[model samples]
Target chain A: MTMLEVLDVSGLVTFQDSGRRGWQSYGVPLSGPMDWFAHRAANSMLNNSTDAVVIEIGLGEAMFRAKRDCVLAVTGTGFEVVNYIWTFPLWTSFYVRAGWRVQVKKISGGNWAYLGVAGGFEAQSMLGSKSTYLRGGLGSAIRAGDILEAGKPARELAKLTARNFPVEKFMNYSQSPVIEVIAGPQQDRFTEEGVQTFYGSEYTLSKSFDRMGYRLELLPSPSSAKGIAQATSADLLSEGMTLGSIQVPDNGQPIVMMADSPATGGYPKIANVIRADLPLLAQCEAGVSKIQFREIMLEEAQENFQKLNKAFKTPKG
Target chain B: MLKPLGDSALLVQLGDEINPALNQRVHALNALLQNPIHGILETVPAYSTLLIHYDPLTLTFDQAAHWVRDKMTQLDDSFHRTPRRLEVPVRYGNASGPDLETVAVSKGISPADVIRIHSEREYTVYMMGFTPGFPYMGTLDERLIMPRIATPRTLVKAGTVAIAASQTGIYPLDSPGGWHLIGWTPLKLFDPTSETPFLFSPGDVVKFIPLESLESNSLLFDQ
Candidate 1:
């Protein structure tokens, strides 16, 4: 069996796919890649199934050795790749002979990266997914000494250097991002001034951000008596939450829920990140990423999401 | 109330409370939405709202909204279906329950009386959340109802039967909690390898069966 053995793991490295669907009603969060665009870009280059499992490495160094020859691709920002002593750039696919060790150096700008193989990595499936949900104990993250089996490799390995992706033009993780949002179910709960304050001020992502959610620090307003936005009511009955839903607790801080958030939350949601911009927000580095929210109509949000999908669609022969 | 949750999903607030009637309506709508729609990906039903995750490319926000509205008219509120009943055996008091005496003292009743009242009632599953397979069953006997502990424990053993406010549930995983621990069940509430991971689903019925007396000071963990 073709396998990739883990040599050194410095930060969070776990298997991910399109996430566990149809299981949220059972209280299971859809745990998938935080940066969907990066994950898909890697997989699309290989022509692998969109749901194919790939290793999602967080901001740190990781090393692996290939037991058999296979074609591979890596996508996302910040991290240098060295394959068999040959340095390579990001957002492109390459071929490796057996026993070639691949090393990913520590990331500097972005928080997440995706490493996709020709077919996909084999993993223990639970609830119709191979995604590793750390809290749920469904699948395990990649650890030192673990052997990961790879699926069937491609027959042709030519044009490795010729086929390249223009990732710099589309996805830039180094800049401060303004996230577009759609108004929420509890928009009426906030005062008009509170809504204005949310859009008017820029916020910083706090150190306590994780895959569950990102706790944001809202810059204080000069006019408001209180330092933060005030809500008509602090709590609501527990309601269903989606990925990128910005929930505001009584503390007035807006927390954007990610892939592994709780199924239901009691805090009132102020806004939801547009699906198209979710990948951009995902690349925002914790504590260093400054973010702002811009409100848009639902139709515009939907149209933007469609445009993103169209960009990734392969040309029809 | 229908609101756009994000670019890809819509949140339908069926009601504001956690009543059985409201939950039934949520389930009815959930079942109707299960049928094939052009772009409906998945639907998540919570205590009071149903969030539908769909593909924006195939269906617009208005089209999906109108589709749900048409489905809502066909639901029969009077229709009743018998739910699967699960009887869970629990060991009450002593080592199995650290807060049993505290709960009895607050209720102004004897420990045995507290056990009797808790075991006799048939609780209905209001929802499943907080953790995987953790069922939130509710409307305990008024006299037995008590507030959650002021300070939640950092680590409570899995399968520990806990009560907070009017709802009672079992901790499917060994995690921190604030509910009053009255006992523990030996049954596994969540098993990842099982064909059916959860022993109970929303709209199911549950009954607690008190096991025979055990030697004092003997913890359930010991067994």
Candidate 2:
């Protein structure tokens, strides 16, 4: 059996697929790659199934020992994959011989990185997905000494040609980028001034953030304009929350829900990052990056989303 | 009220009020839309809203909105199904409920009276969220209504039955919580290994049955 043995791993590295759907009604969140664009790109490089399981490493390092010759790809930033003596570039696939020690170094820029096998990795599927919901303890994180089996290759031979990927589309780590967002359903919960402050001001991601969501602090301003003001009735009947939904608690600070956010929440949501820009938001490393939100019409958001999907549709080398 | 939740999902809210009528409408729409529609993905039923996720490429927002409006007009309000009533055996004091005496003192009622009142009513499962298999059931007696703890405990044991405001819920997993703990059920609300991971859905009926002693209730906590 083709296997990759985990010699060492850092941070929260876990197996992930497209995520679990149809189970939200049972209170399960869609826990998958924070940067989906990177996840898909890595899978596409190896020609794995679009929803195949990959290792999602967050700001940490991982070392793997290949048991058999295999083609693999790594995407996202802040880390480099080293095979004993040779260093592999990001956003490209490479063939590793048996007994090669592949190690992902510590992330210096971005918070998330994805590593995908040619035929995907074998994982225990819970509720139709291999995605690990860490809070629920559904699937498990990769631990040292764990044997990760790679699926049988669909194609026997690997294509030696390494093609370039449009990094700007889905790859941005440690850069301060203006994220695009659509006004959330409960935008009215914020006053007009609050809305203006939200769109006009810059925010820094707090250190106390994880896969569930990011807590942001308002940047210092010259004017008396501070954080946004929340409505008196801040609590709502709990409703289903989507990824990128920015919820404002009584504290008035916005918390953008991530891939592992609760399926439903009671806080008032002021905005949601557009699907096209979620990758950009996900790449904004906590405690290292700052962000600003740019409001966009739903039509513009939809058009951008289509463009992103189209980029992935084109045949890769 | 219909609102777009990002590009992939649309949320149809019946009303924000926690009442049977609003929940029924949400449940009715969810029940009707359970079957797969062209390009439509999964549907999640919350307390008073049905969130529908769909592929934007196959179906535009306008098309999905129009389809939902059309579907709403044909909703069967009289449609009814017998809800499965789950009897949860609960231990009301000691380690099961750390705040039982505190809650009684706050309400100016005896601990035994608190248990009697809590166990007497059948709570409707309004929704499930916060964590996997955590059921948010509601409409507690106004007299027993109390605010959540000022500072939430870092870790609340799984199966802890807690109350706050007008709602009663059980923490399916061991999680941090702010609710006033009153009791705990021996039954597992969630089991990932089981075929049906969740013990209760949005519309299920749950009746808390107080136990004299949890030591004898070995069948409930088989784990």
Candidate 3:
């Protein structure tokens, strides 16, 4: 087996896969990579399982040296890759020879990035996942001087160099995104005018956002409701809440659920972001980014979901 | 009435209010749905709703909805036996419970009286969430009702007991929280290494015993 030792690490970096499922009943949130689509794409390129453990880096650089020759792919917005004195853009698959030092510079585009090695990284799987949950203290992030073992033996020099690893074509990370949503269990909780405003006005992403939820600042409603007494906050019976459910607390600001969100919540959910758009929202750049929701029918949402699933199931060369 | 929470989940709601009857119904339905039933992946019981999450591929939304609706009709006929009860000991007030005075003042009672009232009642574990091992025990004595802190504390010690809005829970791990602290327990509510991580499951009965009983029991067990 080949191994990679971390010389230095920056920001919050952790080993994540598709996430641990079937444990929500135990009150464990499904904590995994924020961008599932990008993670899957990187895995597809390597012909590995989508749930393979990869290093999820957020805002910082790291230096790693391969003990044996290996094939790996780096996917995200952009991670600066330094090969000797040469620096190159990330998000593409490349081969690293044994004993070669690979350094990632500061993040260029997205807040989080994924680095997938062929055959995946090996770690202790708690509840069948190597994903780290910082809130539950389940798994800690990768740190300096940590040695990680790769699953399979490294390829020979000639075989490794001959392998062609290219980046997969995907949506642009820098574009302004529109997330589609379906009206929710509590859409009626908000005033009719408030509902109209929610779909009509553009809200800005707030600084107080995290893996738990993204808080959006309220924008002026074009058809604002006046003099309607705030509905008494109901003592909701906690229920199973999923990622992308938009919860509107008493302040009327919406908080979009994320991968690490709690299993249940008391706040009323006005809408749920469609499955196809959740990945786009996960890769959204922070700070004052406007969000507009377009109402989508359930049938249409399911159709899009099936299409994405079909795309994911197709064998990639 | 149950509503489709999303394409993958359905929320079966009993009532808007948190009545004891509604809670019992939720728990009963949760137990029935625990078995490997068709189209059901997991059944999560809460204060008044039971959320059933299923895979859309195996079970269509319409089929799952109909199955749940059929189950709801049988809820009234089913009989529930008394649940197993566990007595949990606690060291109340002082450092363990910083909000003891505040809770007492709001209830117009002495701190000692507050402890008496809390210990006298047996609570039901409504659900386990918010944090792992943080059991949402419900039906707290009306006098114990208190609002959560204006600003949540950055860190609350593990085993720190707290109460808020007719509910009581113990902090399973040291994490940021806002519930009014009332006591501490030595017993670990959650251990990830255990086959069953959580000590108490939904619908289990919980009674609070004093620290003196805990010490006496420990000595007896040692002998």
lDDT of 2 by residue, A57-173 (tens): 896789999888888888888788898788989888888888989998865667888988888999999888899988998888899999888787656635622645677654345
- Per TM-score, the best of the predicted structures is 2
Which digits, one per residue and each the tens of the lDDT, describe model 1 over residues A1-317? 55688999977899999899877777888899998888887877776778888899886778989988777788887677887668877788888778999998765777787888877888889988999898888898789999988776444555332346676656556548888999888878887888887888778778787788888887555733342365576458777888899988877788999989887788888889988788888877766777889999988988877776765687211
Evaluated at residue B100, the lDDT of candidate 2 is 90
* TM-scores, one per candidate: 0.94, 0.95, 0.90
| Candidate 1 ranges beyond 4 A from true positions | A84-86, A159-162, A172-174, A220-228, A315-317, B213-222
Q: Report the Cα RMSD per candidate.
A: 2.8, 2.2, 3.3
Which ranges of candidate 3 are over 4 A from the true structure? A78-82, A85-91, A106-108, A153-174, A219-235, B37-39, B217-223
Clashing pairs for model 1 are none
The clash numbers for all candidates, in the given order, read 0, 0, 0
* Stretch of 10 with least lDDT, candidate 3 chain B: B214-223
For model 3, residues B20-51, the per-residue Cα lDDT tens digits are 77788888887667675666777777878887
lDDT of 3 by residue, A1-317 (tens): 65788989988888998887777766888888887766876676566787888888775678899887777667676566787896644655677778988887765456667777877888778776789988887888899989888776243323332233233434545535678888889777777767777777776667777777888775565453331123555655567788788888777778898889998898888889877677777766566356678988876777776666654575433
lDDT of 1 at A272: 92
lDDT for every model? 0.81, 0.84, 0.76
> Clash pairs of candidate 2?
none
Candidate 1's clash total is 0
> Which candidate number maximizes DockQ?
2
